[model samples]
Target: MLRILRASGLSSSFTPFRALLSSSSSPDPQRGLSVVFFGTDDFSLPVLNALVEARDCDGSVASIEVVVPKLKDPSAKCTIESVARSAGLRVHVPNRRTTLKYWGLPGAPPPGGSDGDGDDDGEPMEIGPRYDVGVVASFGYLIRPHIASAFRLGIINVHPSDLPRHRGPAPLHHTILAGDTTTAVCLIDVDPTAFDVGALLARSPLDLTTLPDTPFPPPLPVLSSTLAGTGGKLVRSALRSWNATLDAAVDQDRLGAEPSHAPKVSKDDAIVPWATAPAAHVLRLHRAFAGSFDAQAFVTLPARRKPDGARKRVKLLELDVVAAGDPAAGDAAQLAPGTIAFDKPRKRLLVGTADAVGVAVGSLQVEGKAPCSAVDFANAYLRRLLGSGFVV
Candidate 1:
């Protein structure tokens, strides 16, 4: 039987279903596990889909519910709420983003009740396991200790990078920016105090060499999609062999690998350091952030007819490293870093780098103008400023 708890002002609804096992009992392989799935972005969709499929087809998942962040905009498209509803699954959301920090599992007793100390009313708390397990993927908020302890088994997270490496909010973005040749999707136990420092439950390596058509260091979206698919399979397998995978889990701190951090990508990262960074570095920056909603690489160019050295920001929409044999590449070697010149023969804008190599700009967008091709930018913005050689 399932019981629904509906919120008054928010679109949140919770369906509490009894687990096959008792509160103190371990998961029964024959009966499968009840799951509370927490996720938010596109990367989380594949794993959620896998669990939903498992619930219907196999015995790996008994029941599943989704918990997403409250929708701030009702008309927003491509949200997890819409996706879960379309799949006919019950969804739960917090009243506000900050509410998650004090959130408790649905059907679980309120904090400061019989489960611990009595509440202000001195009423007894209902105590028992609310769900068999919790699974989180790309759910930006932290799950507090009280919320994690409500489940029979603690929360498991699907992290994009290998354990003990790239541990933070923007692992995928950091992976691409670092030009790493290999990465992996990992399933780990969620540490209540920190993020991405969980015990490793499973992992599937993404071999860059095997990606077809594109050269090494493919675009961020391509790599992200591939990793998401792998993560789905890995989590499914872990749940299918629940006991064995749990018993074999290893602590990330004990793993001997050096730890690294992947802080959130910011506007500062979008500023192209043409004067100090190499051409390859700039290319990596473009690949990492070009597809992002806000963070795209940009250069500060001198404003037209401004004696105060006023500058305008031009976003580099598309960029490529100039081959050593290209004529523009040779001409760029003679110019200083941050210097830009229009290559008439190639019909592209070439900019020098710190390494004396040039990078070709395929398309760009001025501060207030629509994106335009390199040829158009050169014709309109470069022709008049050629005497001074429009240096960024």
Candidate 2:
């Protein structure tokens, strides 16, 4: 039976997969399944590594083949590719526009599928021998029927959010920005036309609020790392005796919820509205944008008249919340919102926000300057002109 582990909390152990593997009886471990994997990002590393480790440990997974995006430069470093190669896994960089081309099937779309407008013509072309199953995580491209059909048992994907929710690319960012307390990793049967509409093989929920023991919410990478570990475990469990459990997969649509999409995070999404947005919201934005592909959350502070008479934007990073009316706030209570004040008693730079809440600045980068501590930034630039005055 398929198992569902909901987010009351998460266990750091890989005991779940190990337990399932030990009890397996359906397909003999001696027969051993071969796997072809599709993935390209850092988030996919853990899952791929887990599979590679499994293959090394037992004969359950006989072979590992990886497919990655075509690199513009042959010398470009792909972390997943590097890890896969180090594990002695076979790697293929297939062009999504012409997958069949990689296999010498000219004029035909790739076996699984391509990013083409229409479906393949006539009958589906057959690719060579098929692997037992396929797995994907953050592969960044859709699979066509031809490629999917090449596998005897089709493909399964490790998605970082609960099915029927956050059913898009940037789940990590959206989950944080929305103030979600919990997130889940789902191992789902891949569907070609619709994204993440596949049947659920396994679900492991993670409690985001309980991590890191911090006063504020955990950072984006913290939750991402946790989910990645959970995802890897789920994949291993789904593949063990997969022939038997595949048929038992549950339909996600029946879960009785409409999924909220997590579109790619945009530059506008990272802007910190210190003067207008709620303190919690500002903090969430900072936490969400931290370590993201895009730059960190920032607000443009008013520029002081320089010797050159040029104004520049001050990009802030490492923002943390401080309760209003802290004794160290001193005269900060009298300053306008968005002001930069030094909390001398606490030895931190405090940025005032809406509702009398203060955001402790750990680090910041002035335009055209290297990143520096908040105190260094104030002493070198802010204190001279603004004298701990309004930021804007």
Candidate 3:
């Protein structure tokens, strides 16, 4: 395994792929070619590991460099850079103003002139033969066209969706929100023209709507499987396949390609609206955006009495919607959408909505308590002065 990986021309900034490079005692396969990898998120780890593994497994890879960004979140506390360092790969954090320039000096005869090592008093420094190919995923920077054409091979990217669709910034969240049943791990040509156009080497679809009643998805991972594991595996396949055929290109269907964009979900996106939204719709929104967006919904509490007999608002999170009163058929009052209904003894919250939904609250996290259940939540908090009905 190590021998094959060492020579497979493998490279990427993804970190989890370290699992692939777990073998040793072999000639280093990544010996001669210049390969660069960059990413910041853990999501990129698998591909990064797979690239290293491919070099060992196939014995075709050359030199590899890894790049990771500095994280702003104090809670982030960790990154793929440590993984790259552990693997003994060349790694750098890029800061254009301070780190490496575009490897170019402005107002020169373009780069690639002659060696500064040769005492080039008259000529500019020629960039040493650079990167045969480059791979990028979730690195959070834009690649210019001039840089795109500079690679001896080309830049291959790991985009989280199928080509021509969900192009630009967000793919995963957009796919789930659009309720797309199928998505892919696409290997794309990273060029100035646009992403998803350089020619597709591999495509694998993600099954989101296919969830099952069981806690664990058993066996031959079918429709209804949670996508995390499957998506990672599919991405690995696409990267490996694309590596095997470096020069091939496939013109994709330009017609079905409608650009739907998802900017990174913000704290505002997580403000679960108790008005105008039923629990089911709100639930989906939370799940889709939760990991990246902190799956949460906001609701103003029903009028509560103070010692002075006044009202205050309480926001909620970590909630679930159960079948309201056992899914009856036309046997309920038509509360205004976003109105609150109750099962006080059960500590249940039933929120009505424009969609004609009455969702039973599952779990909840208040401003103070660790995230807990609605029953536990209300028993301790909401049940007091929480009217049996809504002000609306």
Candidate 4:
């Protein structure tokens, strides 16, 4: 449901998917299941919207409340708030300074406010429930025991990657990084003080073996595309099924867990080090950085003479993974890891990697200009200065 919104990006930065989510579904909450949702990213949009749609399908929300972190920017804040408000969903942006207690129990309101342990940081805390079940999806804030205990059924988080696996931030990136071909969309119950400890109610496998209809290269575009709504659809379907078997949602094993963590990646993490990366790692790096936080396979070039006798450098973006079988692989394999070798007449740019794997450059952005193809990049900016020998 929300995947449609991700596909319709108006700009590279903020996703307008939330812009259309409100109008796409009905505003009524479902009967029986009342929930308090806590989320702050695009990953959480589908489950939240689905909950709203299911409840509002017939024109009335049985019970639902939202606790969203207060985004400093109004555009960002209003995007989700407007969607919720438009759908008649309750939107709760607890004051960080006033609601600081965990679960926001009737205690001294809260230090600084929002809900978490005693802390003076500006970050918002997950103030516990004023509702029945607490549902969190891609919520950046860490919810403490106070918050989880406040809810009768505990909190249910819509984790993108399979739990007991990629258990922290950047699950999708971590999973992709580990090169796991199979993963799951899990709806786990969050027990107090124990993250990933709640019962495993639903596990829907995610197959990443095949690329999407519209393919975006790694390191940047892929992670930022916000194209996981179909995955969310599967989660919504699984949740509905779980609701039927609510009693069966049992606690998972504490042992035998191969836990992994994907801490929030920063701009500094985006800098690619071609000298050390293996082919597989290089490919994975690009995919992990793709959508958000400036995903790209950046390059720096050696000084080469220009028509005006000045040395020129290049910055390349977007690379396609290729194996030894492709016709371009052999030629690409010979170029240096960061060299730019172009077959402009055929519109091909060969990018070599420290690993044996070769990457074919597809789209690129040079000094101050729109994204251009390998052919254009070569003809206009390269070619004369680079007679080959430069590696990908």
Candidate 5:
């Protein structure tokens, strides 16, 4: 059965199996559930903050603790540890990855005690506390079976995509690249064996209609923040009615067809494929990687006067499709794909694509140089190569 709750232009829905409730044990209503949350980055913040808020206002959450990976840099900004500490929540850092396999729960004795003593390999002999449940969001590490079993109700994950589809690390990026019109946040049981192949506790669809004037398919950071906030709300609702939602959870195989994967984005995805890609595709790439720190779309320009025909990589900092009937678009239509030409009247740098319409580059960064406007780039680099047969 599915129940819908709407707020702030977003809809939260639950898919629960009535039959499972009879067999499952429910949390005590008086004290609520003791939750240990696992998360790491910016995407994890909303959910973490939501849990903290819920713990304070209602009895649904009795106490909350956070678990984060040991940061390579302790002073890094915007991390889960900092946020958790600010909220006055107890934070746990495993000595190493393997330590979690036998680590104790919050309220358990410190390591080296009878309840927390581990083997020489850092594998604890006796894990303790056994919290009511564990919540994971954007926590990349897999929870081992022993650690998962330590929680009475097991662990639940707040994933950004609907399970059984886009089931990997980079769902938001892939969703924009595919131009998906609809997307949702899923609350699922954490399958110990794999990622995102879990039972659904709740699913919430983001209302794209709310963003009528925003860029089509919305930029990556926009979509991510929207979904993360929605996921946090859904989680709060689920925890408040923990028993009912958990019992209603259904397997991914029952929810949809064959799974489609959203693989991790790499630097290669940033390399513009001008030879065969249309201008619309370039626009999609720009949107997909807009806020990405490492993988912004770029074009390779052949050296202007190099004897060995070397090429320089220029990162496309900002891009847009040329409007229809624009004179620059008409002029760019005459050039071959990958050809680069400056639009003097508009002060724009246009690049030819597989389609007749071209992509206009608003800002770009030449190799080893600071980012500059299209006019500056044209003056500094395109002057000699404009009519000299140098194509991007």
Candidate 6:
């Protein structure tokens, strides 16, 4: 079962049932291409659905099939299998027998069938009668060179970031952290070894016009879903002519671009050392990780009534950045950075930062508690402080 919980108060309204039109007007799939798609995450759903829709409408694909979702957790819900099966596409799970009972479909590929067949002997086997190409989007596993070579046209990937930049698992997070105003999606030739080092087949730029210079930008999920939609279109376009697209592929190595890496984000990297970091930087971290599981920013605070100085971690979900005021103004200088204060009239909780910036908590959650508005947080934990001059 998939456990659904709000980490950063962001949720995806995207569903795979809906299909967006491709950029190319009236894409003709009569190019005699059969696609074997590999993907796992929700980011891959749109691309999968788009191809299925194209195959249903035009002859864009002679046949469309999918690999069993590369599940991160064996027991977790598989988005790729769920979506592919729902679209009535053939799903192949490596080393596992396929049956109608497996996917709850009446007429799916049977076990030991050619579709789920593998080239374990290092010998390249024909993918299938109509299967000539492969499409991968956000697939968790790397395709082996032998498996990649089996497809007549090889594989193409829909990457969310611009080629040679922000290449890795956390591209969306890194893009927001760097305050990039523009990011793009690219369809590239899969190299099967390096990350996003593939030759480019097509590219589409996404304007992040909503990212604020100081405040939190859009959540990572929203940006990822948007890019996924754009990537789906680009994938569809590439299907129109794989041979021509591959022939026109541009080598990223020749571009002489110094690429920034976005390795997977870790728990330690998500914790905000509020006392040492600038408020602007902290805000960026909050925004960048807003939608990431286990990565929202948190600050350690002393318990209100515990004289023993027992500390509690309060997770920040949403916040606003306020320009730093002169510390010399009033008693502002007397408060230490990370000190909590309340604004009664505005009903906001403000945390002091080293750089004199004030971060007004828009939403927060106590550890092991549901997220609530800042006003609610103050009411629950700082009610007495609210009466005593708004100090916490």
lDDT of 2 at 193: 46
Predicted candidate 5, C-alpha RMSD: 7.5
Q: Candidate 5 — what's its lDDT?
A: 0.71
All models: lDDT?
0.71, 0.66, 0.50, 0.55, 0.71, 0.62
Q: In candidate 6, which residue ranges exceed 4 Å CA deviation?
A: 1-31, 70-75, 94-130, 210-216, 294-311, 323-335, 383-392
Q: RMSD of model 3, in Å?
A: 10.0
206 Cα displacement, candidate 4 (Å): 2.2
Residue 328 miss distance in model 3 (angstroms) = 7.6
Candidate 1 structure quality by residue, lDDT tens digits, 63-117: 9998887666756633677899998998877545544433455666544443322
Residue-by-residue lDDT tens digits, candidate 3, 1-392: 00001111122321111122232312223453456776666656776776676567653455667766545653342467888888898776543422222333222233234321233333123332256556776666654333333445556677776666766566666665565666766666564444444455555665544545521111112221233333345434544443344434454554356555446556566555655665566665555555454445433344445333433323444445545555521222365555555555556666665566555556656544476766775566554444433322
lDDT of 3 at 250: 55
lDDT of 2 by residue, 290-379 (tens): 775322433333345644334445555777667555675545445556777776556677766676766777777766789898678767
In candidate 6, what are the lDDT values of residues 2-28, reduced to their tens digit?
A: 111111211232111001121222223
Clashing pairs in 1: none
What's model 6's lDDT at 3? 10
| TM-score sort, best first | 1, 5, 2, 6, 4, 3
Q: What value of lDDT does candidate 3 attain over all alpha carbons? A: 0.50
Candidate 3's error at 302, in angstroms? 11
Q: Runs in model 4 with CA error above 4 Å?
A: 1-31, 58-61, 97-108, 111-129, 210-246, 294-317, 366-369, 379-392
lDDT of 4 at 120: 54
**For candidate 5, what is the TM-score?**
0.83
Worst 10 contiguous positions by lDDT, candidate 5: 1-10
Sort every candidate by lDDT, greatest first.
Answer: 5, 1, 2, 6, 4, 3
